[model samples]
Target: MIDALHIPDFPMQRTCPFDPPQEYAKLRVEHPVSQVRAPTGQIAWLVTRYEDIRMLLNDPRVSADRRHPNMPLTEEVTPQTRRNIAEVGRSLIGLDRPEHGPRRKMLMAEFTVRRMAAMRPHIQHTADELIDAMLAGPREVDLLTALALPTPTRTLCELLGLSYDARDIIQRSANAQLRRSVSAEERQQTSAELRAYVDQVVREKTAAPTDEDLLGRLVLSNRETGLYDHELMVGLTMLLLVAGHETTASMIALGVTGLLQQPEKIPGIVADPAAAAAAVEELLRYFTVVDALPRVAVGDIEVGGVTIRADEGILLSFASANWDDEAFPDAATLDLARPARKHLAFGYGIHQCIGQNLAREELHIVFRTLFSRIPTLRLGADLDDLPFKKDSNIYGIDALPVTW
Candidate 1:
């Protein structure tokens, strides 16, 4: 094991756009479960191997509760920042044990394969409309605004029965929360903004409730229960938006960028269901945008021949694991037909992304329609000049300029 003096800083810089920081490859074999200082200046374990990452995430001894005093913080926290963490706990991502299971089960009712299949036509229509509008306007435009951002934003807004016009309100706060470069006060401010936005929507629903959409349905069914309480529902609504919107939006843009680099591989991605599914899975693993999935070790657990003591913060590196040579052969090379569905891109176990089905459908339809209709599509900007979201908690491009 490396000495404490050499422990690297957390969220190491990525030297390659297509790969993680090379330092991860060194740690994967040498110090698989190693400690690093977070931006908050607190020590946290960085788990890098695929097998160990999978094991620990599925381990019950760890907790996802952000309220844990020792849970990883990417930035320094103030009293209000601690309050922000507590408030964020109301979301499903930060819940643990009893609260997590029941909450996830309730939300899972809306994300079943059947339910997602039903949304295919709607997603397709949305994709086509955006493309039609984009093509009519300019020969060259930023795909981020034209398709990527609006695709998930509009879908999520309509799903929650919120006006699509409120996307600016949703995107602004969501972006702020994902950026570690932002100060704690800024993070706290955005959290409150998100909370307030959700509260207003729930209030309007409570005043005139109907079973037409998710917000309305939840309100109608849990009228006399805590599940429908104003605060809880606001948290739940915010969770759905935070979980569903930004990540998928990032993936859509990055996925197109990746495919554009390998044009010969585009047909396979658009040709058939099997090929497309494999391609999506490979892209998920290839990128693994959610780089730092935080957990607190609630009990001693031996992983990677290292014992992570109780209360130690853990940041599971899905990026390193997906790219681990032991897990996926030739992990650096993107092979769409390699049957990569088992990759940890959506994560593993209970805390895995609750909105995976919706995300998958959105990406599948968006990519299929975008590439097919705009067969001549190519990057309008030089690949080297493109800005990557290295500073944000989510890994993606800031913008993708494309033209056919």
Candidate 2:
């Protein structure tokens, strides 16, 4: 039996900088599904193996309901929990089945393959404009500001029919919510402000409703089918606004860092779109940035020879699963040709990212355009001097100093 004190802390920081927590590598081989103490002072099971992570995430019996008393949180129990539920309610990611299915179905229609295909031209244009600005600005620049951050923020605003000028408002609110370093009081206040802002936008869209954008369509849906309400729209909008850009922004920065590390592989990817797309998948797997997918067991379930009793919390390590040697041989090495579609980077099951198509398109456009334009682009600072986000739930560098 693993000693309670010896059980590695959940969400351990990466020791080797670019790699996932070293504890994950050891746990996957020695005890794939081991119990651990959370930062919140609760005991929880940490699932590290790829098969176990897939099984639990796909299992209907497992609950994503964050309201559950037994749910394990990486953060300490705080007043913000109750305030969040009261003010904004659960976003799409936090809801369980029955409530989850219809809401997801309604939104899925908006993110279909055809919709992403239609957005390709705009995504391409956005990438080109950003690159033009970056190239003209300076020999030394922080890439996160010039390209990685704005590309998705602007795209999401356009897709939702919101003002690109509101990027400051949206980004500030989003950063407050995502960063673990922020105080609960501050997070709650910012979250309230964000919801109010979205609610106002929803009201405006409802007043002068258009069918062209996601928010406008949802407003139209509420009127036609009577299936949604203002609160639901606000929740959905808040989710899309934050998630739509923040995660992709993190990926862009991290992806570029990963590619710069293996500069020899850059040529093949830059020359061929097909090769670049393949490399994008590999990059997604390599930097599995999301730290953990939290869930609580509603009923007894057997996984990896361990009985997860009712009410026991489970944290699925996406980073660990992506790095599993069994799933991807020599998993540590960056192989641009690896078929990484099966990786858990976008997650799995019904709750898998609805924006995967859009995200994939954006990544393809950004990587191809950025590298092809600035063939001499290289890191401006020493690797050790760069500030990586070890504390944030999303893994990425604070800024990428680049010189071309």
Candidate 3:
């Protein structure tokens, strides 16, 4: 019997430094749903198996709402941390249907396959501009600073009708807000700053409207439906700015890093633009950026034969689920040619990422252009030397040093 309490020490379940504890693999095979201590020191069930995670994610009894009062926090989280979490929880990702239904519907048309396809040329142009700047400079460059980060940040700025030049300040505030070690006061201040910045942008867009950008459309839709209030709109905008830019940037950097690490793959990525799409899918599966989406049990639920009590929290391990042996054979390896790449890198169920298509388009354009232009691109430093952000919900390299 694998004791849940015996799981190795982990910094924070969501942080990059915190790999799935050693005992997780054994628990997946032995006891897929087992009790574990959360970062806040609260005991919660961890669901590790793929099938079980899928079931739990879609289960109505498993609520994404954190305002349920009885929701559990990780052992390491403070009251202030809980408040921050709750603020973010107000977004669609944390709501169940009929609430999630309408908000997602309002934005669904914007992110459909057709809309994303239309955005490809612009995404490609953005990638090219960034790449041109990178090549214009010295041979040595930080790919994250020059290309990976700015491309998506600019893309989202265009989509949301915000200024691209605000990327640096926005990214800095986002980083500070996401850090677990930051003092409660610091985090609160950062959140307020970010909200104020976004609120100003929203006000500007409302005053001088152009074609329907994300915020404009959202503001219009909310007025019609009377669904989301001002705070919700602000939260949603903040969510887009943070969730949209950071994760996509990480994927671009990490995907390129993955290719450079396997020199053999570079030729294929360069030779065929079509190959980049498949490669992006494989990278998402392999990198598994957003590890898990936490849910609280609204009512009693059973997952993988374990009964979860109402109000208990669960971390649905999307990363582990993607690598589940049954669903993805040879899960440890990255196979760009692998067909049927239906991974939950975007997540699953009602809360499945709303911006997935946008993310895919951005990655496709980025990698396609990068590999084709800089065929000789190589890592300038060892993987270990790369800075990984210390404490964050999203895991990614801090900087990607590259040379061509």
Whole-model Cα lDDT of every candidate shown, in order:
0.85, 0.84, 0.76
Alpha carbon lDDT of residue 401, candidate 2?
97
The sequence of per-residue lDDT tens digits that candidate 3 reaches over residues 1-404 is 34655753333343333244345566678888777665556567778788888788778888888776556543234466566567667767677877788778887867889878877887889888888888889999999989888888888888887877788777887666556667667766777788888778877766765556777877776667887766677778888878887888888888887777678877786678677778888889877888756778978887787789888878777777777778888876777776636888998888888899899888888887887888888889987777876566666778888988
Clashes of each: 0, 0, 11
Off by over 4 Å in 1: none
Per-residue lDDT of model 2, residues 18-133, tens digit only:
89998888889888889987777778999999989998887888998877766777764356644464334365777778887877888888999999999999998999998998
lDDT of 1 at 54: 86
Q: Tens digits of per-residue lDDT for model 1 on 280-313?
A: 8888889888887888999999988889999899
TM-score of each: 0.96, 0.96, 0.92
Residue 160 Cα positional deviation in candidate 3, in Å, after optimal superposition: 0.2
Error of 2 at 286 (Å): 0.6
> Candidate 3 local accuracy as lDDT?
0.76
Runs off by more than 4 Å, candidate 3: 1-22, 70-81
What is candidate 1's TM-score against the reference? 0.96
